[model samples]
Target chain A: MINRTTTAALAAAVAAAALMSSGANAQTANADKERCYGISMAGKNDCAATGNNSCAGQSKADYDAKAWKYVAKGSCATMEVTLKDGKKRMGTLAPM
Target chain B: MPAQPDGNGLTDLQHRFAHAVLQAPLAVPSGIRHDVRPTRERRFGVYRNNVKASLAAALAARFPVVARLVGDEFFTAMALVFIERHPPHSPVLAEYGAAFANFLEGFDPAADLPYLPDIARLEWSHHVAFHSADASAADIGRLAELPPEALGSVRLGLHPAMAVIASPWPIVSVWATNTHDATPEAPAAGWTGETALVTRPHLDVLVQRLPPGTDRLVAKLAQGIALGAAAEAVSRAHDSFDLATALSTLFGAGAITTLSQGSSS
Candidate 1:
């Protein structure tokens, strides 16, 4: 007993809802990830861990050891690494 | 030519300043003059030096091993030649050295170090892998769950940062020795070619020394070749190709990012 126009509108609404959910899922996935510091190799850092330069590949020393790169959620501690000060510490989600 | 105004309009002034910074030191561009009390030419020289030094530092940052191989003086001179020819096209400095390895191949002074170009290539690859976009590791468990009949037609996608460099020289060893060591030693008399696979699985960018025929496997898989077909191709090329070991290595390195079944032909 539904009219053609009503059926078409319902279909469009369902499609829009699906698209919104997918977009939300993608955002959540991205948010779940974090940048783990003190693990990236020299010239391989994702971006600035030190506030000096606003670019990648700017680490002054090999394993500048304080620089960071992004890793998946809950994977930061597993990347236990040695820092520039010769202290072995696990990577942190927050910039060190 | 008639002497243009000491400062043309804003647009002309900007153009002249840009030229002065990138090209020459004393030849301060015609339409622009420094406001400092020091001679205009001398003040302009400071800007000129900063531009050249920073760009050279960028090159050194991008190719530290290359700079280390050739001493600082030679590396800076060579970097200047490269910077002049291939000025950065983008604001992103990490992407600046795409042409450097090829430039080294034709550089006359570096002719003695024949392997320098390949070494540069390796460094560039490492640079690229460092900044490449992140991707979730492929679900190998799902790959294993596929039916045997469906496995032959499955294509794999590699992580965005993965790259394979096949070189005729012992470039991988040279890179490892120089990059990780303060006092790099020369390679032993007996040196052989190396194939390297660069990837960033977790947060660390790794340079793995790959065995023979493995680079071909990776290259094929990257091109969307089915797993079975890529393996067969490698076997055809190398009689001793080990499929199990290759797959294990790929998974262990977290190189593969996605797996999907290809339509059977």
Candidate 2:
């Protein structure tokens, strides 16, 4: 259950994740299912795929079976990050 | 002589992270370290909180039943002490709590129940075995084919994950009562003593309560004593020690593997 403080924190995290999600579809599809829309990629593997709109893929279902599917309206935008050991790798990470 | 910004190495980062984590509690010097105001200090606080929670969860993982035994408040206190004293030495979180049982032994609050620590030990042993490297049991067909003469002098090899623990307390029963859904009994009394065998034969490691005298034999085998000598020791400990039954029980469970032939060492 997301509390007031946690909900706010998650909101910020979701914002951060959304900004990072481009080009992550392939990686997100294979990752856990809790993720509504994630840009999942590791190392140099650059690919994208969708699980399902509700939460889609492994991530959506991974979190909970009862979670409803999300029908994305606009050109899909979600959240992500590119961590390189000690620092954050900077790039828009948007879908091309 | 020069303040070169070129020194950003992992060592520097580790030190920074460690300091940040330790000092997080002090942030509320006044309603929180916003003492470092306009600073993303909140994020730093959150990060420190996360670190503490993760380590606490790691300790809890090694001792779930212990957590249940102590209650959340006491468990939190215990976990805080364990983390400060035994921060993980390795990056692998799965293999984190070897020293926990001992820590519990020395823990002031839990010291009252002398048996608690040993039960923790048994649990930690279970955790390690669960993640331990897998080795298929030695082929039974080949074992049986070996010459009968070879059996007397054969040195039995235990799988890497085999662990045997003997505690003066009835720890195995205590551990079983809590971890498994069984009828709760009165607080244990007959400290006639207990011994446990924790071994990973395959995917799941089994923790079983062995007869009183079985530990000496298993310990002897663990120390590289030949099967015959180990048998001799167990027989001496308990006149009724059934060598055939015990050996077959272990062998059937994939507990015993690899027999070295030659002289009983």
Best of the candidates, DockQ: 1
- TM-score top scorer: 1
In terms of lDDT, the poorest run of 10 residues in model 1 chain B is: B180-189
Candidate 2 positional error at B244, Å: 2.5
Off by over 4 Å in 2: A1-96, B1-5, B8-10, B23-43, B139-146, B186-191, B237-240
Candidate 1 chain A worst ten-residue window by lDDT: A21-30
Give the CAPRI class of candidate 2.
incorrect
What is candidate 1's lDDT per residue for B1-265, written digit by digit as tens?
6665654576687876876677663377775645764688777878877888888998888887888899889999999998877777777876788999999999999999999999999889988987889988764555666655566667889999988899888787787667543466666534888787787876656776666788888989877887766766687899866665556556556688988887633
Tens digits of per-residue lDDT for model 2 on A1-96? 223443343234323333333223212111222312223331111112333321111232222222222212332234333444444322222322
TM-score of decoy 2: 0.64
